[model samples]
Target: MIHNKYFSEEQIKTRKQQMSSQWDTVLKTNEAVLIHSGEPIQKPGGLDSTYPFLPHPAYFWLTLRRRETEILLYSKDLGWIEFHKEISNEEIFWEGEKNDILISSQGKNINSLENFLENHRFSRIFHLGQAKDASPEAFELKTLLDKTRRKKDASEVSFIRHIAEIANSGYQKITSVLQPGMTERELQIAYESEIFRNGAHTVPYETIVGSGSNSAILHALPSQKIIKENEFVLVDAGADIFDYCVDVTRTFYSSGEMSSQHKDLYSIVLKAYHECVAMSKAGVFWRDVHIHSAKVITEGLLQLGILKGNLSDLIEKEIVSLFYSHGVGHLVGLRVRDTGQEENLNPKTYFGARLRVDLELEENHLITVEPGCYFMPAILESAYQQKKFYDDINWTELKKWYDIGGVRIEDNILIKNDGNENLTNCIAKTEY
Candidate 1:
């Protein structure tokens, strides 16, 4: 039931006023701002007449208004500018007025965006689409915002932890309804239905519902595969609420019993997983976290006999590419890849080095510490054949586990003043 007393109009106004103060510096420098209000595209040839709509997460965070064909305007003179589509009879007939619901419910101004901007006369307009390379100042603003979100204010933490609870609930529902003959798509729908039932409006991204050999593909697209005995099920799904997200992954048995091989891999991956988490805190370079995580995975694989190399050689060669391909994790916020500058762990003389943002860890940063070891053929072959160091890898053992698929564990973390909080913990390893 929707609570009529929840977040009263006055409370929202106060919050918006507070946000305006926070955005003051960014506004003072830029004359005009351009932000998009995303309109979801219709599914191709689907029978549903509903036009799907989702506001861009960033736009939602800045304006607190969720409507299509509207733009947010900001300048030094004007406190805040809200723009909406001009309603005409023809337009209203085709698209019933979205203004009444948006304005009344959200307390946003109902003014035409064109008129708002045309009258203000900013010398230049800046939008992400037109940016070849984002201005350094804009990048700095984004980083500051990232830092702000890292430590969840009481309200932000409450929202994220709440989403984690919903995600955990979805996992529980999936387990109860799961059967050997179910298709991946059907299972995906079941899990997502639970998310919606618990008040989550959108999945942070695509739901990964892989079963059987399909589980080996790290970011597997849900397919027609049926769950089978002695096979693994890897699910990576998330929930986005008020532009904050909880990313969680859990792999478990569909048959309520684990195979010997499955248990072995699970144990190895989980051990490395905990090690990665244990090392995270403020002030540690992310590169150190990444490489240390890689070391644990590499050692675990070497012990599994999937890879054969001296410990240093394996770590140096990154021989574990036969198992893992992607970086441990990225920043998570308004965007799954939250806005930030790319920083490096090593000060190496390389081409991408120039692109790296010499960033130092600071308090109150939200980041995802995900570490996975997947065996993908395209990446595996390239690493072994193209790279000199990886040339000595044991191809025989690698190919055996190549069919074993992959394992990825992800969690959204909040860097605190002294330590960190795992916001996605509720959904991690959800056997309850």
Candidate 2:
């Protein structure tokens, strides 16, 4: 059985009030006639079982409830209204009683949903997308609530901090007991067990415990491969606490003694990590931060004789994509990849092309700053085939480190008005 916990009633009320105010402003400004919530979903093949229900982040941001068959309707004059199905005794016996924590805490006004369609009709309904139960005439909302969700409120920050603490504890547990010959799968179990023991509801994403050559794969799955001495282990994992997530990554040397090449590469990645953290502040464009991180990695590779050309010229030519392809970071909140976007930001560059969130940093914005360098044959070979950066890259020297795999150091950061705060700062770096 899974144990559940929630924020205090006062905290829930505050979040509700904030959401209501935001909705009020949005409805009035857009002159929306009505706003309708999306419906829930169920599994296809299961007889009576449903997939783990995760409410739409926008819906949860408003109602905090993960109900399966409920809809929220809002109007400027009527305020927020909920239509809900009355639970039967059979359901109570089979599925357990409805907690109604949100209703009781906020004293929400709910109405029978049996005849909702017959009683109400809307001409201009704003919705995120089409739903089976929603009106076909509904028009898409120009700006989604995702934009407003960028800057978290007090309660959100608290939840994320708790997640970070849990993640830190899990990392500490794994590092203290890790040993050579342990399978990647074993490490995954140990880390996940620690997360559950510390009160995390579930892992935010798949637990990555990549060892040896597997570390070169950015999103490698934990396998039965046994870790060996002198190899690197890249563990990128996080836990979910009440839907809030914390993403963290750490790379460790299996022998507990870093090789000369490993030391040099680790130092460079660590420097890039800290430099990105220092540069993440309110009003800073995320694209600029990404570019700065790529430049740092490019410069480091050049110093290591891995690349051959002027630093600026190499970076401008997208040579950094050969090693550090993924984005330096992304927004983190209710979901691991939080929903938000900037109209002017384009994340189509060869480097940092997979950026999930691209917007100017704002106060209370939580994100992950993960910088990495990998020796992946496919990515490098593809670039070489395209004749991209052939002059800047020293393929012969890079080939020597192919077996070295990769190194990544990641942390959760909260952007502040003055600067930023690293939420996972308590977690020790793998260099130790």
Candidate 3:
């Protein structure tokens, strides 16, 4: 029933109007905007078949229709006008336009764009296209559009929550089937199978299933490498059925009885995750929250004798980044990596630059709060050569736990005025 309502004509129209309403609120008095649904190109080297036509997110959010060469024009004088090409008889014969019944029938022919532009000129034209090949006016409003979309409406929130439930099914399935000598690719297959079985449209990204030492590779592709006993299996994946998608990560230790050392390492990541997520609220600077997450991890490391120094001094020197790389999280919306570029307000340093969003965390803003502690070989080897933190970091202690690989705990968070909601909390972080 929910799936049926998700694709209903009423819901589709409501979403289109939502985009128009947002545009009108942000649009200047004398501005006209053009959102282009990019043209199609065939695959390279004389192939007739084209790559899948994915409409621009801005265009898709507005129209909820995926037609190539479609243009949405907004002007103060004309209100909102959709210039779209009707499905041709030849194309309709091939695939059939079954879903056209839900679309508006009042759109102008796409060919009339030339005349429309000539007659309907405004002070500034905001042209939005693929890869943000947009006019200065459009580029200026990119962050605003991002913010507007980030704050999901009631229905949008429901859709995100529903997809998360399906994703959690996948996570749960992996635990039941987890065993020694199971290949990374096999685990990926098991997880993805459950996601699809639970009614996900598709696995949003290349499913990450890295085990043992390979788990240290953040974006490692699922391979035939065996998931050994007493090591972490890091699975970072999501279920995508609607335009909104959720990015989630869970690290599972293969053995039933995790050693005390491994448990301590994971506890540090969980501690950071809780501290950073607690800071999520309206008007909180995300960068500060991220640094706080690092501080929490640094404190945890100090407790375990991995790093020996004053907490503030270690953080000030960024010795924490040696293990805890990447930001606390980023916005997750239409795209899993749904962060918008903050105009003239980005982190310049090596550590802070990793954070995607610079905006003050706000109500209704849905984001990922993933805190991780990885013992990556490349990063550690380079840091060892640099000899920058010889005293700050206990080299022998760090090497002792190298086999544990990486540990990450991720959950989707919906920000609120006072606090936040954990959207993916239904999925267990640890089984034991």
* Every model's TM-score: 0.79, 0.88, 0.91
- Best model per TM-score: 3
Stretches > 4 Å off in candidate 3: 1-4, 7-30, 98-105, 121-124, 131-134, 342-345, 350-353, 383-386
Clashing residue pairs in candidate 3 are: none
Minimal lDDT window, size 10, model 2: 133-142
User: Top lDDT: which candidate number?
Assistant: 3
Off by over 4 Å in 2: 1-44, 98-111, 114-117, 129-144, 342-347, 350-354, 383-386
Tens-digit lDDT string for candidate 1 (1-432): 111322234544554465556657675554655656655566778665546566754555555556766666555566556665455898579878654232334223446555666776777665532234387655544444444444444545666677788888888887788878888888898899999998887887899977866877867888888877666778888886655677788786778677667777777777777777777777877767666777888888788876676888877766665566556666776556665454233543211112132344566567777777666666667743547545456667767766666666778878765778888776647331
Worst 10-residue lDDT window for candidate 3 reads 344-353
Which ranking of candidates, highest lDDT first?
Answer: 3, 2, 1
The per-candidate count of clashes, in order, stands at: 5, 0, 0
Model 1 TM-score? 0.79
lDDT of 2 at 154: 70
**Full candidate order by TM-score, most accurate first:** 3, 2, 1
Q: Write the per-residue lDDT of candidate 3 for residues 197-289, one digit (tens) a residue.
A: 998878778899889888778898999898888888899999987446889999988988888988998888888888888999988988888
